[model samples]
Target: MADTISTKQIIKPENLVHKKSAVMTDTTMHYCPGCGHGTTHQILAEVIEELGIQENTIGITPVGCSVFMYNYLNIDMQEAAHGRAPALATAIKRLMPDKYVFTYQGDGDLAAIGTAETIHSCNRGENILIIFINNGIYGMTGGQMAPTTIVGMKSSTTPYGRDVSLMGNPLKMTDIVATLPGTYYVTRQSVHKPGNVRKMKKAIHKAFEYQKKKKGTCFIEVVSNCPSGWRMTPVESNKWMEENMLPFYPLGDFKVPEE
Candidate 1:
């Protein structure tokens, strides 16, 4: 008779390299399979827990795919009106300066209706972090063309692909804000690959540190993929994003602190 080892023996604790952060609740995530939002939330929770700020952190998210972040992350959270996360975050930070306040926003929420809030808050050097997820389309609202949608990109609204003359050009919101005086750090990142995920986590950690210093606004744009919205499988969407989206919205630190 052949002896069989138990499953526990096959998987040992010593081999465990990763575990869910306690800062994340057990609530089931509603994000689509293979969506980058879940990964982003995990990294965020890990960072908050690592910094020992779970009890003091406050996150604000507006109407969009990111609106339900509070349900996933175990931290103080606020829901804002459509595209108003930045405004809400600004108010929260002002009232409670000691709290780690940040806004989680999607492309439509951050680059379109909330553009004014995003601009003014950064212009004033609001001591908060802004996590912008730019998937190039309005993922929650039926995959419509968003402000960050690249030219020649096709969405529900632009079935023939986006035309610069008809639809105007894509908004480089991250670059626009980086040039403003109030921004201390600005970067564009992605989470489709393991290396990119690590880079994003590092950027987020640094952003929170800067927020602790009350230096200025730290804007990080995560160029993610919308598999359902893009009418492609998760793998295809990632490939498309790398080939088309990244070229228009390159990933890297656009601006950094003087030091």
Candidate 2:
């Protein structure tokens, strides 16, 4: 009988293309299949590791699918009430000025119930990062329409489709935030594809770097897909988001401090 070669001895470690970030805990993510939260968390973990701020960073998670972020990311984390992440983050940052503070919020948490908190915190020029994941609908709350839910977008609340005339226009929160004087940097990105993922990673890195500089609110909005909420498969949601969501929430930097 021929001797079997050991697998570890056959493959070189140098050829490895990707590895899990050390900042991410072994805890399994609880996000729905094809949800963007997992990818977003991975990128955030990579940024924290690469910036060498893993030990000094503090994250605030709001009431939404992202609430589990504290368990997945191997860093100090705090939980806040629905739409209250910014408020909690503001206090945390004020108390621990030396720490890298950030908030992970969903569309519903950031743009709806937490609207006041979100606006006030950014307006105050808090030196913290806001990672907003916008999937248009309230993903974790039985797919109800959210403040960011676009026209004609279907949700449990809008079974037929979103009627802008009756429901009000979709709130462009990122654009609104960018216009505020306290916001030092703002950008919209996605992570459905490899190129977009790379771009989003860069944006996250820049946000963290700016945070260190004490730059006022660095907001990064991730226009992501929610297959479960959208009533589609992961691939279908990605394609639909590309065709429908991207046009309204265009990707690219919306604001940056002038040198």
Candidate 3:
């Protein structure tokens, strides 16, 4: 004979530490385990939920691994062309001034092909959020070297490590955007650990808040890990990112509006 557990004992809300955000869909994520995309999606969804703007939010996804952000975030989503998320976001926000618009783009999509759109959008002071994921390589199309790929970093395209003399220096898109006078808030964050996730959430929340104020462009660069693309186990990739990626792309705010 076995004893049955009581409903009260099983349903202890007080002991619950975390729960899935209602803004996320039921579809299982396709990202590799330990990929930061899932964590970023969760944080974004949680921010939308907390701000009670699920219905009024619009998200633009680029043609990278994060292109499926529409499938995960339970909000109105528009698929943008390759490296065109920022432009799409600019148009949507201008057309629907009352709606909250944001773009989710990977390094290749933002720092490389979309460089013009990114720079112009921020230069124009578009009131929208830009979530840039910089994992150093093109995570979706193939682990090709990206504009943000660090020199000496190995990739499918740069099998022998990136040569600065040949490939040019890694573009610091976040810093570049921050330099634009139209940008109101710009920050770089990561989400590999519990404490880091908390900080990322705060940065995301601030971006959204600034959006509501009709402030200039708000940009957030999430220095993420791409274990599958990097050809390393999840743990090893994170370790490498901390040791290698962090130095080039240091975390924290690069620009903020003065009170």
Candidate 4:
């Protein structure tokens, strides 16, 4: 008879392809299925663990599904008012110059209500990382049209689809910030696929590195999906994001400092 190996015998550190980061808390995430926030959080945890900066990192989360980030990431977290994450992050970074500060914010909070704070923070070139999640629609506050909502996108506020003539064009906040002198690095990425997830991780890790160099502000915009909010299945939402959102938001670096 052939010898059989126990499952435990097959499990080894070398054989482990992946494992949940200890930097991430064991608490289950509250993001909707297919939501990009969870994936972004996972990469954030992995980057923090890889850099060995778990204790030195501080996160600011404002109003949105992202506000629950503190529950998932095992790190110091601060809560901010709606659309005020950038402002909070600014203060924290200034007071704790040695600590790595970052803000996890949504499109509504970052682009719409907190536009002033977002712009000013990036403009000031604060030594912090600003992770912007643009799901198109307002996920936590019901399916409402947000500032980043692209043309013809349907939302509770735009059931017939967004009319550019009346609603105005979608704001390219990342592009806006990239032009600011204070921004050292600015890029837009997504986590809808395996490749994109890897790319986002790299971008985030790079941003962290730049922050350590005091390279002003580094911003990463994640074009994410909202399944429940969009009333679409996970698969359908990803496909929709690929076809629709990608064309409008388009993933790639919008800014980088000269070497």
Candidate 5:
């Protein structure tokens, strides 16, 4: 008999390539290599898959680095004007109570320009999830000063460091949102490290669960890294977030409504 080669010996193209995480697709993300947005996006996608809400979820993309978020998440999404994601999410959730609604917003979009929308949405007890990304500077706007910019941090606009006297201190959205009776769950987490990433996933899951219960607004503020805006390499950006940002914005659940 002729020599027979084992079928197993044949290399499979799929096997040769590394397996991609279920949470993320093979599509190349536009975020900077070290940008925290990619990590947070993965976590959110994982949570959606785990909860089996991907089909029923609708995400609102705000005008920021995440304006292209709809391109990444394989779910129904709508683009909202700058800082208007909360208002759009509110209307969507109100109309489609059976569907899951969420808004992905940045510091400048949420804390500065959309402050009114964010506050009113939370105050009105809107049943939606708000994923607020606070990276201290405006990533998409050429590193401009943001409402959440830490005191003494320098940005393109604040070339000489953030002046608390003239610009005001960093706004703590999680703390402010938690105070609203309409808010069902409020947490602040980060993606600077593996441990923190795990915690952030938990917080994201919890926010979704709260929405499932039709409780009220659930807000999760993620202290993310903006390497391009921060003018640091991806590795250094993560490290900087840990050393300088975490102290001001600790990661943990700020509030959870009682059953």
Candidate 6:
């Protein structure tokens, strides 16, 4: 007995849209709606493309929302343990001096578990660029309290607002990292508004440029919005960042090396 049958084709997920821009690749991002990580990823990719460093660039991703950054940015990337992106970046840059090395990390991954790694890497004057995303909570692990969680901001761990007496005040990582003598460039920018996004792109470009020139460490902290964790609509989250976060983490260039 012979039987003939036709199988229906499966449709791909709608979220898997191909990016027309050369900077972004054809891949689906796992970020929640209105998340800022996608915006930051695009800016970084655009900067890398504009500077023509994709071939020579190496990205170190940490264990956070950005852990899958390699899938978005069409470049060489290596995954590192939580908060160890900076340390891994240092080693990579040291081994391959000609390569453009950068680390993409979140607030919890950088300011908390990776605090020592971040500080020591900066102190060593490693030729690397650090893209620090300070969203104020541990986005990947159910929005728990992070080292940068502002006082009075409630998280999974700090259900009744962050208690300074128990949890301590938020750590200003940009200011702290800027104090290291080896750091060549340091800036804090936001991704909420279009104007600020443009400024952030410029800052990212400068950081990559410094790394390309082997000018030492360049650290950029992007004050991002976490709408889901903040329990607000995307629009409201942006407003919250402008109103509350900006005052505590003022946006500006902390340091720039002599030309």
| Alpha-carbon runs more than 4 Å astray in model 2 | 1-10
Model 3, range 156-242, lDDT digits (tens) per residue?
A: 999999999899899999898888999999999999888999999999888888899998899999999999999999999999999
**63 Cα displacement, candidate 4 (Å):** 0.3
TM-scores, one per candidate: 0.96, 0.95, 0.95, 0.96, 0.90, 0.91
Q: Summarize candidate 1's per-residue lDDT along 80-128 as a digit string, tens digits.
A: 9988888889899999999999999999999999999999999999999
Evaluate model 6: give its TM-score. Answer: 0.91
Q: Give each model's whole-structure lDDT.
A: 0.93, 0.92, 0.92, 0.93, 0.88, 0.88
Backbone clash total for model 3 is 0
Candidate 2 residue-wise lDDT, 25-87, digit = tens: 999888888889999999999989999999999999999888888899999999998889999
Which residue runs of candidate 3 sit more than 4 Å off their true CA positions?
A: 1-11
TM-score of 5: 0.90
Q: Which stretches of candidate 6 lie over 4 Å from their true place?
A: 1-20
Compute the lDDT of residue 60 as modeled in candidate 6.
94
**Regarding lDDT, does 2 or 6 come out ahead?**
2
Provide the clashing-pair count of each candidate structure.
0, 0, 0, 0, 0, 0
lDDT of 5 by residue, 1-259 (tens): 6598676865677656433446455678899888889888888888888898888999999998988888788889999988999999999998999999999998989998999999999999999999999999889979999888888888999999999889988889889999999999998888878898888888888888778889999998999989999899999888888888889988788997777
Q: lDDT score, residue 100, model 6?
A: 91
True lDDT of residue 50, candidate 5: 83
